[model samples]
Target: MDAVERLRRLCIDDPVDDAADDPGWSDALDAHTVSLVRIGALIATDAPAASMRSVIDEAVTAGASLQEIVAVLEGLIGDVGLPRTVAAAPRIAAALGHGDDLVTDAEI
Candidate 1:
């Protein structure tokens, strides 16, 4: 499966918990976030960006609004914290710019 599919399965199978889990939780979360950031960067490329944007735009057009997208992104950022999130934002923004009305608001 693709990284996004793998990530979806991971999310479905194992809900993240920093407190209840073992000491390795932080490392695992970091690894997962890094992988996602890489995927975001890859998706931002000219070839993949169009496809990715189309999917995201369809989702948004269906029911998901820009705020919802931003909330999901911010939640991911909250999970990973500011430093990592800040580092990941540009790539993610680039990727997201292809689809929904992402860059319109300053909140993202």
Candidate 2:
């Protein structure tokens, strides 16, 4: 298992509610998509910023695009709140090799 998976397993207090996959769902949750979302969740939950960078790199290597990463972060705003999205911007920027971008508190 990867570092993220290890952390997730170690941290979860309760069992995850198992949901069977629905093939008809428009947005299928493939490995890459799941990785993208995992990256965002890590960011929101105050995992190391470097962790986000690493996961972002892996996601890109796994065929996820920058747009997809941004979409994940954007989508997270509603569920995780503005601060979490804002907190993620710098990490995302560094991961994308645009580290010079000045990410503000509300940048996302």
Candidate 3:
């Protein structure tokens, strides 16, 4: 199987813990890239707002800048569609500690 198929099996077919413990799949990429990709996956899937914190936190811990994180969200708009990206924005913002900004202003 190809990398995509392996990833699908690892993430969906295998047990969660097994997948987590196995670094073989992601070893090629740096932690920062992995974390950023996770952020993209979260956005693409329309994941729960509560789930955003840990994923964003991991991205930050892996040395991802706020710009990079936001870029992941923006970049996915083309692939995941505008609505999904927009829906994910609030969650991503909250995760990055700018949650209050959503409530405060309409500069755009």
Clashes of each: 0, 0, 0
The Cα error of candidate 2 at residue 31, in Å, is: 2.6
Off by over 4 Å in 1: 1-51, 81-84, 87-108
For candidate 1, the per-residue lDDT at 76 reads 61
lDDT of 3 by residue, 1-108 (tens): 356766676677663444556665466789999998889998889898778789999989999998898789889989999998988888778778887877444411
Cα lDDT of model 1 by residue, 1-108, tens digit? 344654675779863344355333344545434434434343333224445455554544456555655554566654556665454444346555632454434433
Q: Per-prediction TM-score, please?
A: 0.33, 0.64, 0.76
Error of 1 at 35 (Å): 20
Per-residue CA lDDT of model 2 for 23-98, tens digit only, reads 2222456768677767877967967767887888889888998788888888888988998777777778877887
The lDDT of model 3 is: 0.81
Runs of candidate 2 exceeding 4 Å displacement: 1-29, 102-108
* Candidates, ranked, TM-score: 3, 2, 1
Q: Tell how far residue 100 is off in model 3, in angstroms.
A: 0.7
**In model 1, what lDDT does residue 106 have?**
48
Give me the displacement of residue 26 in model 2, in angstroms. Answer: 19
